[model samples]
Target: GWARLADDPKALARLPTVAPGATEELDLHLSLETRLAEATAGETLTHGDLYPFNVLLTPDRVVVVDWPHAWIGPAHADLVMLLSSVALSGIDPEPFAVRHPLLTGVEPEAVDVLISAQAGFLLAIACSVDSTADPRLVRMMTELGRSSLRWLSTRTRSSGRSKSKG
Candidate 1:
């Protein structure tokens, strides 16, 4: 589930080079911390980790595994992580979206926002895990962060432009 995110043209176009100690990581972490704190304060559900590897599929049903990263927060956060991981595996998220609409809720844009934030947090964590030794993880985190930043930047710019026009 790391292929599509790594291969997406738009995502790649916006990808930034791997630069440890950069401002982008700092901003991303700050934003994530804010969301995490808010989620912790309010009503929220946890997932630990919902990657494909942890999902056990049978002919009749599917079961999710793992329970380390689990935390109470907005359900959208978990959904975003699941969908993003699916997308990364070069799979179409639309099918999953259709099957489990409740997982994502009504706001598609919010899904994007959540995914961007999750990616940033994940990237930061990945960077801290021996980034110098694992070039692949380092690259993945760098790209993910860049993609998240680009998406956030676009959202901000669009919102600003709309406000100006109003």
Candidate 2:
């Protein structure tokens, strides 16, 4: 379900260039920072890396596999990562939510936040893995990373307004 981008080369070339300090990078860094800070304060549970491949399913049973990246932090962090991966892979997340009742009560916007965070993390990992040498995966990571940054920026702005109102 992972959709490959046509502009993979361009996208891969953009990853390392994307970072916090750049004006375009602020929103993502802010959202990640906020979530990380909240996680540090015990606001959420962390499951380092969660993706569909790590999920095992059978009729009437569902199991979460892989624990290497597991940690205690924000639950949203895991959720975001899952959502982003789903989007990147060109899969509809709605079916996943329907099949997994635990996701039912989560707000759509929160899911968006989770996707952003997840995408950013994945991008960072992909970029770090010598992505420059692998053009296809590099492009996928780059495009996904860009989407993640945009999502983070939106979430940051919305949260900022909410805090100001309160």
Candidate 3:
């Protein structure tokens, strides 16, 4: 998610529409990059975009189908992305978070940061696109952006008003 943000300066520039104070918020987050990095020190496989839509389940087994975003990162990062998607689906994340093995030994604050980054990246992309080019897709992105932003705000406030992680 951070890599996505880093690669899209134009989109990042338009993020304030969906996330107010995005520049300062991202700057504060950037300052804590090393700490965030330290929190997930091990090199493990991560499903960079783990979400409900990317998973497939059969009678016999579960399969995670999207591998393009796969990379070496903290295992908890994949869990965080999964929880974020669940939250977007109007599900409470607490129960799932408690049971997920990937979240073992992970800091709650670190998860919050990852979720915020995911929200911010989505908002940037949603705001950057040309709406008229594809109204239905744009509308979907807009709604997703709004939900993600709301989730970000709720997480921030609950976490004592911390700025988002870029």
Candidate 4:
């Protein structure tokens, strides 16, 4: 479902208007579908939801508990989700995310696509007229969507990557 919306050109194009202040994200969508096709094609079982609530800490090692959204996607997808949850706490997690052992050797564009996809999907849900979702749920989606876009903006700018609309 999220992937469908993410790869839709109409959905990507609507992101700027759906997410306030996300106009610059319009440029970030360049090649997103192509890159995602490669990055997300993997055998790894990423959690798809890796927030603290689903994680456990043991003296010996860390553990992940949730599996409902698990998928055969890039390992870095979980890392991106983890970092996104961290960002919601008002802390910037990019610096640590980039160098984290999990994301080691992962392409920069791979990470960018996940952020873009999630941002687009989340914002779309919040803006959807058919959404009978609660106001609180809608608000949460909107906040997380905006947060994801901000994270994307920071990552793209730091990497000196931006595509001008053709």
Candidate 5:
């Protein structure tokens, strides 16, 4: 269940520092503990951890390798993950995400919650005190966390600056 991805209280605390205006909207959705399972229910089979490292593209076809994070959930989940990674690479994913078929049909608030959950998860990771972890990894997580929050803020405020692809 997506409920397993609940925000850690400490990470939740850090959100106001990340984006003050977005948290009230985030908190409203996050507080609905029962909605996640219902919201994510879908026939689409999604690779819950779909990032670039798990995908390989050859001259002919694309291959997805990792399966550990695979799950049956909303079609938007994997795309959102990928677009979030796109943000980490310094691209603005909003232009693509707003027009994407999968995301366009999803409730905007639902997507916001997923983005917030990721922001929470990644920021919590950035806060972890494992001395052996690479400095680069910690830095990447912090950057990704901040980017996701910014994206969520943009989404929550404008219903996205980009119009639907329809």
Candidate 6:
């Protein structure tokens, strides 16, 4: 599980240098896990990893590969993962989000939560693995970790401001 990995000692130890103050925020990932669990109360079939290359589309039918991470969770979780994966390619996910069939009638707030959770998960993965010990791969993973940390930090600040104003 992503949450499990986030809490793993090995995972934390493997993380590259992150932005200032981010370490404190990341240390609270367990609280994020609790929030995710609460938002994901409704169980449904979900393909955990829906990255662009994982799907195959020919002239006929479309095939989805990689199912080892599939599980039962909120429907929006899959949409969140797919959109987040798309975002990794520098594409804006908002326009695509509204058009996706799976995102129909889904709560945006729930998707936000899932996205935040996914970012945290990615941070763990980026930290824990060396990716064949390639220098380029290590750089990419480190960059991803930094990006996720920035995103989480921004979201945390915005959420806190929103709550304080209400």
The residue-by-residue lDDT of candidate 1 on 30-128, one tens digit each, is 444444444433256668477667799999999888888877776556665666665555555556754785654444444444655566555545434
Estimate, for each residue in 62-85, the C-alpha lDDT of model 6 and write its tens digit.
999999998888777776666665
Which regions of candidate 3 fall more than 4 Å away from where they truly are? 1-36, 39-41, 131-146, 159-166
| Model 5, TM vs. native | 0.73
TM-score of each: 0.54, 0.52, 0.69, 0.77, 0.73, 0.66
Ranking by lDDT: 4, 5, 3, 6, 2, 1
Which clashing pairs does model 4 show?
none
Best by TM-score: 4
Query: What's model 2's lDDT at 160?
Result: 59
Model 4 spans > 4 angstroms off: 1-18, 56-66, 129-131
How accurate locally, in lDDT, is each candidate? 0.52, 0.52, 0.65, 0.72, 0.67, 0.60
Candidate 2 or 5, higher TM-score? 5
RMSD for each model, in Å, please?
8.5, 8.0, 4.0, 3.9, 5.3, 4.4
Q: For residues 19-134, could you state the per-residue lDDT of candidate 3 as single tens digits?
A: 56655566654544435556555688887777677789999999998789877878688777666666667876766776788877677667666665666556656667775657
Q: Which regions of candidate 2 are displaced past 4 Å?
A: 1-23, 26-35, 43-45, 89-117, 131-144, 153-166
Best by lDDT: 4
**Candidate 4 overall lDDT versus native:** 0.72
Worst 10 residues of 3 by lDDT: 28-37
The candidate 4 region of ten consecutive residues with least summed lDDT is 25-34
How far is 145's C-alpha from truth in model 4 (Å)?
1.5
Candidate 2 clash figure, as a count: 11
lDDT of 5 by residue, 2-104 (tens): 1232345654565466445435545443543335666677888998777787899999999998898788988898888788888878788889988999877
TM-score of 4: 0.77
